[model samples]
Structure formats: C-alpha cells, structure tokens
Target: MRFAPLSLLISLSLLSFSAVSQDTNTVTAIENDITLKQADFDSFTEILNKHLKDESQQQHQLDLLRARSTKLEKEKNQALDAMNALYRRLIEDPSLDISDTKLRYQNAVDSHKTNKEDIAMQLASISAHRKDIEKIRIDRHALLNTLEGLKEQKNTARVERLRNEFNRDGTLEIQNTINCKRTETLAACEQRGQHLGMQKATKRFLDQVFANLTEIRLVEPKRNSAGARVQVLNSHVVNSGFSGHGNYDVNLSVTMRGDANNSRLCHLLNLDNRFCSEYSSSFQSIYSPQQSSNFTGNVRFSDPVTVSTTYPEIEKKSQTYNKPVVNILNEPEIDYTHELTLRSNVHDDEVFIDGVSYGSTRLSVQLPVGIHDIEIRKLGYNTFKKIINLSKAQTLKARLVKNKSHLVSKPIVETQISNISVPGMVVIPAGSFEMGDITGNGLANEQPVTKKILSDSFDMNAKEVSVSQYNSFAVETNYVTEAESGKGCAYYLNGEPVWEPSLNWKNPGYEQEDDFPVVCLTYNDAKAYADWLSSTTNNEFRLPNEVEWEYAARAGTTTDYSWSNDIGSNQANCGWCGSEWSNKSSSPVGSFSANQFGLYDMVGNVWEWTQKTAGQSDVAVRGGAWNFAPSLARASTRLILSTDFRANYIGFRLVKER
Candidate 1:
C-alpha cells in the first residue's frame, strides 16, 4: 500500500477528535439537564404534599363550623318556641301578672337573638374556610401536574443522551467499515450489524418514553355546595294617617334577619340589593341578629294599602279612611220640606247639609224646615261651617277662605255671576270654528278640515286639574287609578315609552309639585273623576266631545296653534315649545300663556281625554303632552288610545253643560 500523506493523516485525526468531543459534550449537557429537572420535580412534590395537608385541615375546620352552625340554629329555634309559649300563656290569662315569668320570657328572647348571631358568625366562617380549601386544592393540583411534567422532561433528557451515545458508536463503526478495504473482516461486519440493531432498539425505547409522557392526565378539583338561610320576624303597625295630599305616614316596627341574601325582598320594592342591605342595616348591624326596629316615615302609595305583618317594606300606596261609627236614636218624625238654595264665594264648593252631600254651591235642594248643620268644602280652601234654621225658601251664602298651607296657585279670578260661573271653569260662547287640520300640512286624521258649530254654550275647566285637586277626589272617594290597579303607567325611557309597574300618577318617574297637572290617567279614570265631580257638584261634569274639544282648543283661531300658524315660544309645554319644563316634565297649570278663550294647557302639558270614541274600544285624546312634539301639540291634532291605556303623558279636563 502507498504511504498516506502527513497532512491527510493529521486531518483524519483532527476530524475524529472533533466528532468525539461533540458527542461527549451533548451527553454531558443532557445528563446535567436531567439532574436539574429531577431536583425540581422532587421539590415540587414536597410542596404539593404540604398543600394537600393544608387542604385536609381546612376541610375538617369547615365541617366543624357547619356542625356548630346547625347546633346554634336548633338552639335558637327552641328559644323562640319557648318565648312564643310564654307570650301565649300571658295573652290567654291577663290576670296572671307574674314578674318572674316575664323575666324568663325576656331572657329566652335575648338568648334566641344571641344564638342567631352566633349561627351567622359560624356560617360566615364556614364559607371562608371552604374558599381557602378550594384555593389550596387548586394549587396542589397545579403542583402535581408540574412535578409530572418535570419528571417527563428528565426522562426525555436521558433518552436524548442514549441517542447521542448510539450515534457516536455507529459513526465509529461506519468509519472502521470504510477503512477496511474490499476484503473486509468477519469481525468488522458483525460489529456493524450489532451497532445497527442497537440503534433501532434505542429508537423504539425513546418513542415509548414520549408516548408515556403524552398519556399522562391530571384530575380536576371537585366543586363545593353553597347555600344560605332566611328568617322573617313579626311586625306591628303602630300609627298611620294621611300625612299629605298624595302621601301617608306609617309608624311601624321592621325586623330583618342577618346573614341572608334579601335580594328577593328588594325586588318586591323594585330596588337593588345594595339598597336593601343599606336599609336593613340602618335598623341594626348586620353582624347582630334579630332585632325589631321602629321605622317612621312618609309612605307614598299609588295602590290600595295592604300592610303585611311578616314584612313591612315600603310600597307605593294610597291612604284608606275608616267610616265614622254613628248611633241613631228613636225620635219624632218632622214631615215638612222646604226649598234651600246654597251659594259660596267659590262657585263649585261642595256643600253638605246634615253630613249628607247636597251637590256643589249655587245649588238648589229641598231640605226639612228645621235646624240643619251645613258645611261647605273645596280643595285648597278651608271648610266653611254653620248651623241654620230655615222655615222657608232662602239662599245661604258662605265665603270660603284659601288654605295657605296647601296653596297650589294664586286664586283664579272668579266670574262675576255666581249663578252661571263654576269654580275652575270658563264659559265658552256658542260659535263655529274650522276643526281638523286648518294648516295645509297636517296628518290624515287632521284632514277634511271641516267647519264645526256649537249650538249652545258650555263651561270648561280653565286649567287642567292639578295633583292637589285629583288627590282630594282620590282621598274622599278612595278611588284607585287604573294605572295603580292594573299593571302600571307608560313612562318614557330611552326615547320611547315603557310600562313601569311601579309608576303611577303619584310618582310618574319624576318629582311633581301640587300644582302640576295630574297625568297617568286612563279614559275610564277620567270618566270616574268626572262622575264623582258631577255627583258632588250637582252638574253634568263630563269629558268634552271631539268637535267641542277642537273648537275650544282652536279658541276661534284657524291657525295650527292658538297663538299662530307656527308654535310660538313660551306658548305651551311640549317637546320643542321653548319652555323650561318642555320634554322634561309636565309643567304646573297656567305655567304658560292661555289660549284666546282663557283656557290653559288646552294644546299641551298633557293629552286631554274626550267623550268621542275613535275605533272599537279606543277613545279619542286631544291636544298633546310635555313629552310630545310641537306638531302633536297643534290645536287640530288628535290621537286615539285604548280605554284602559294610561301613561304619564295623558290627563283630562272636564266640561259642564250650561
């Protein structure tokens, strides 16, 4: 064989040394990685064990707290039963005035309250412990998974080392086989075959190791049960009365249990949980248990008063008056009747003779010729009373004084003739006016602007009825508004009307003073009010007919509005009427200039109910409201609504026959 060159021999030696060094470094690095991962796995395993031990301890504590809570609840119930028995015995036999027994009952009540508080505290503690246990279990599970991943990494590193070793040995064997010329030895061929077999076996082992790591799965933590208990206490109504025009005052005891979610109670009042919690805690600390606290405040009602002893929460309500008990004695009958005419400075003041309504003032009635007690009453005015002995036909006049405390507005100028002028009313002269859309640009309903004629004069309310006026009728007659009796009134929200069950005339989604025109009235409600007024005033009080309403609204004007063809500023309260209360709320009656006929709020403030019907079960509504646009507020505009439909934008004005 030819002698190899020195340079070639040196190159071969250097290449072999480089390959061995590379293999050695790879194996050493993989071994170091396995060592570090093994150490981390061991450390994490220890931490997971510690977390598991803590979780076990917390679970045990939770169990103990639950048991204690149950015991306290049982004891509290027993104490309550004992107190109830003692109370019943005392009530059954009032003769027994045993001080010792009373003391025992008081002690039992105190004990019950103490037990309730303890139970609450125990439950709170248990809840906290359960949370801690859940956290610990979660951490422990994560740690276990991390340990398994670290162990797998360690195994993978070892397999990588084995692969490196096989590569190095196979490379050496291949080199030796290349160096052995055409005539290869048996020993070299056997070594090459053995290296190939070893490489395939190592590859299979590494693949198996990866498969085992991929198959590892972690278990999820179990969920815990959550619950709470609620208990209501007995309540008693102490005092109640009509406190204001549309509100009442009720002094009562309210008791709320602690450690319970009272969201349901808050929902009943259409309030949030935070408000409920604050209200409940106002009586006593939530940490303290059952304690009866006295609550005294004005309770405004939109519905009938139905007080419950179990729960004394504030509800929209109206005052209920109890009829006075009367005792009649046998007496001789006097059978002589005479004509008696009643008159008052306030023309329509309600008159009562001998405690019976005899219609309004400027009224003629037949009364027995004897001593009679007479009383004249009007809203926003003091009552006028007198005792009269009438033997013949005579006119009795009483001057009513304005009640300063409940004054709604400056006294309206009274008409000169008491025989023809009614209080809060204006006499419209018989005339003809162009009804419907007098302006060329109006809706289809306003079309066919025809000439409407009124053959006879009629009296119409100068201004829409105020809250104070309606409240008087409601209080006297105990009439429940349709909005209050049914679902509720339609209140505007998000640029549209929404049915708000909690809103009514008393609370129409905004604050209203006594003088503000009453809204949230259905056609039936207006009819009922008119009927009541007629019965009390001895006049045919009813909603104005369509032709009459349009004629009155036009006020002898052929323009779109009473002032002009265009909606003038400060002329009315509407969406764009340029009034301060426009689009926000209904203004007080007479807040703006009146129409030509001296009638206020005929075109705005609130839609007026009319006697005319539009479609089946639909009644006609005239004018417009503060929440409506100027176009809707035009004198000729007309809208029809269901008889039972009520909203904050709807009200009424009455008309009396002349």
Candidate 2:
C-alpha cells in the first residue's frame, strides 16, 4: 500500500489542530454576535411599543378636543340665535324704551361674539392635536421597520454560520469515504480522511483571514548609523476583521530592502523584502531582517444600532367660555368707581375727595359712582366745596376766592412769591421745623431729629442749576471744570459708580437737554460757579448749609418728603420715584409737582452740594439724584462726598442771601 511522506503528514496534523482551534473560536464569536443582535432587536421592539402607546394617548386627546370644539360651535350658534331674537323683539315692541332694550341687545351681542371666539380657538386646538397624533404614528412605523430589519440580519448571520459548519462536516465525511477505498484498514482510512478534511478547512480559514487584511505596515523610530536618534513617524494597520468579533495575536516580520548604505529609504517607501541579508552592524535597529513585532488585542464587533426614539408632544390649551347673556345682564354688582381729576386755581391747594385727603391738586382720585363731596382749600383761599353725583369719569376745576378775613387776621408771608430782584430765585420763608428723619424710616445720618429755627428768610434757586445756567457761567468765565481738566466724571453703571475718562458734565454718559439739571460737579467747581454768579448778580450766591437745605427741602411740613411721607408716584425724579426720567437721567427743571413752598425738585433730581462739611476732606450733599433710591431723596438724608470728587449724580443749587 502507498503512504504519504513523513513531512507531509506532520504538516497535515498541524493544520488539523489549527483548524479545530479556529472552529471553536469562530463558533463562540458567532454566538456572541447573535446575542448582541438579539439585544438590539429587543431594544427596538420596546421603543416601538412605547411609541404605539403614545399614539393611542394622542388619538384620545384629539378626540376630546374635537368633541369640545363641536360642543362650543353648537353653543355659539345658540347664542347667535338668542341675540337675533332679542333684536327682533326690540324692533317690534313699541312700549319698550330704547334705553332698556338697547342695553339688553348690546349684552346679547357681546355674549355671542365671545362664544364665536371660543369656538374658533377650540377648533385650532383640535387641529394641532391631530397633527401630533399623525407624527407619533409615523415614528411608530419607523421603529417597527427597524426592528424587522434587525431580526432579518440576525437570522441571516445564523444561517451563514450553520451553512459553513455543514459544508465543513460534509467535506470531512466525503474525504473519509474516499480514503477508506484507497487504504487497507478502515481505522487508518478514517484518520487519513480526517487529516485531509482538516487541511482543507484550515486552508479556507487562512484564505478568509488574509482576504480581510486591508493593510500591513511597519512603524518604528529612524536612527543614524551611530545610534543617535534622527526622526520618528507613525503607521497604521487596517483590517476588515476589525468589525468582527474575535481576539487575535498577529506576528509580523519586517525586513529592510536596498543596500545597507541606503536602507533608510525602505521606511519611507514601505517596501517588502523576502530575501534580505541579516543586519550585523553594532547598532541593532528596526532595519534588521529578523526583527518582528507581535500585536495582540481583542476586536469588538458592533451590531446595527437602534435609532433614538422620541414621541411627539400634544399641546394643551386652556378653555375659556363667555358667561350667558341673561347672567351678565341680571348681575347686581357694578364697578361703582370712577376716576375724578380735580384741579384748582391754587397750584398747591389741598384736595379732599369724600373727606379723604388725596394730596394736593392737580390730582386724580377714584370716587364711588354716587354723590361725593369734594373740597379744595389753601391757607389764604376760601374753602371751595362741591357736591356732585359722579357716575362717569370727569375733571373738575375749582377757582378759590381769597378769604379776606383769614388773610387779614393771619398776614401772608412775602416769601410765597419768587423774588424778582434775584432772577430764578424764590424767597424761602424762615420757619421752625423738626429736621432729620421725622418719619423714623431713614438712614443713621438722618436720625436724632432736631428742631431748627431760621430767624431770617433767604432767596434760594427755585429749581436745580440748569445746564443752560451752568453753560452760561462756563462761557462767561472761560473756565474748565475739574472733571474736564482731570479725570472724567463718575457715572452709575451696574449699580456702582464708574469713572469714565470720556464722560464730563456736558456728556454725562447720557443725553441732557439744556433745561435739565447740570451734574458732574465737585464742591470746588460749584463754589467757583457760585462765586461767578455772586460777582455777576451783585448778590451773595453760595451753596446752602445742611440745616438750611433740610429746612427748605421740608418746606413747612414735618413729613419725610415735602409733599408727604409715602414717596408717592410722580412726585419726584429720583430712582423708583415714579417719574418718566427716574433712575435714567435728570429731567428738565420743574418737571414734577413742586413742594408746598413753590420749590421744584428739592428732594430729588440731583444731590446738591452744601456749604456744610462732614470731615476734613468730605463735604455734605443733600437730597438725592436721579440714580439714587427714593429714600435717599428724603429731606434730611445726607451724603458726604470728597470735596474733589465729581459724579453725574452730584450737582449744586445756589442760595442767594437776602
């Protein structure tokens, strides 16, 4: 009997052992792949089920909105029919007065119009819910398709694996039969046939493994002949099997091609050498033919991933329906209040509405829709009283006649009038008042109320120093303000004072009209302006002392502010004081109601520099500016600023001594 060569048998035996090992590994890999694909399929199924549930909910919501819309439309039609019937009754009934019938018809018409709007809004909501339901259904369908595709892919992989196993087994059986016919014993024939089958299977596995290899590269550092480092670069290895499931240990033999002198070019060219000579140089480098690298790692395979699933959201709308016409007309209660704007000839006369003082005229108050007694009175004017049945908003102008008896008994002061001799100055009457925080809601500096008595009257500016007035002084004296000469004026930014090099009195970081108060002044600057004014007018013009400032600011009233203690709206131009220019910029002089002494902006608009000194280098400023809080605008609130400091919120008003 003829037998195979010893070397050939040994090679076949080794191939058989390798084939068995590879088969076991491949089976495990296929099982893992199938498991991952099944998990993906299950995940997609869960998403599809969830979307189906959302679709049901959305459909139910759509149905409810449609039903509500239909009900609203029916109610709208009924309301329209009722309105038409009411109109026809008004036209047919001759005994019905136009007034009573017209009111009822108007109510009915409003009810019908409101119902129509509600129906339209309901229909719009229904349409939106329907669109939401449609989108949910579409998403559900996509998820279902994805699940089916995953299932099909998983089944196909299983089929391919089973077919490969069957082919390998059948080839082994056929080889066994052929070898039995050629050999003497059945046992030897079976062994020989098994070896042949294994050889074929190994060949198939190696062919597949090599076919999947996309690239083979050698990556190492390049060194000079003297073993000194020269340059280094990177190389990459790519394999189609990277996307398959298995762990592999690949051994690579790299050989350098070309003459030893020019062997460095092999790394750049990526040339493959099969019969290169062994490198025997003292330097053992990457260029040696026998050098090999072993790369061992596990390649993880990923199945087709399920897409992110999101369900459409249904919009919820609020339901609003108009009250019935009968209910609206038969309602017994009414608003009963009407706005009454009261005016008087005297600018600062006290006004009383229903015996409740509503500050001074011109003012507005809401009076009940009934008879209200209105009273307007001043110190020397006859009390004007009126009784009016107010059912609607109206403006009442009262001209008070002078009470000769009161005026003669209590002689009026001459300080009530502005001093014509001193232009733009008002005579402030000498009076005794409790200065400081009489309201007890002020700062520490405003505490310890003290009674101050001014024995003499003084002529003070009726308004804050205007931009026009300061400009006149600047032009006449040809003087540059400290802010313009040195550092620019400080302005409020982000709730803190920031010194801007570009800002000055003329440009206080915001636009200012000529009539607005002039700000960004230091104590010395204000003193200089006062000196200039004193020289020009031949009067002693100077900053008011703190006591004089508080006296004039309080006027005759001992309240927190000149007008009242409440810091009422539209009374001043300070921050949060309820003026259009509050906290933004200084308003024009006399923009708000004046104090009782006919003084404008005594408590707000700008912090005025006073002649009083607080510390060695600090000067007292009275009132508050447009950017300060309302509390800071109190009559007694005092701010001590450095004498050389200049800011947008600091300005000055002159007091001319009489």
Q: Which candidate is the best by lDDT?
A: 1
Question: Candidate 2 regions off by >4 Å?
Answer: 1-423
Each model's TM-score? 0.37, 0.43
Question: What local lDDT does model 1 show for residue 43?
Answer: 64
Q: Count the backbone clashes (under 3 Å) in each candidate.
A: 4, 0
Per-residue lDDT for 1-658 in model 2, tens only?
2222212111113443354456556556656655665575466546645754665565566566566656655655666666666668778885655564455556655655665666566556645654544334334323332333333333333333322221221111111113235324433333233223223322332222222222212212222221111000111111101112221111111111111222222222232110011122222221111111221111111121111111121112221122221132232323335789988888777775543456888898765445666777675566799988777999999999875541112212323122222337667877677988888877555779888888888877878888877887888789899999998998765444668887888998888998888888889999998897787767788999888888878767778876556565566787655568877888888887566555778878888999955534457888877867666777888765557778888888888888
Model-by-model lDDT, in order? 0.56, 0.55
| Candidate 1, 328-391: lDDT as tens digits | 1122222234788888898666676544445677889865444666878765566798988877
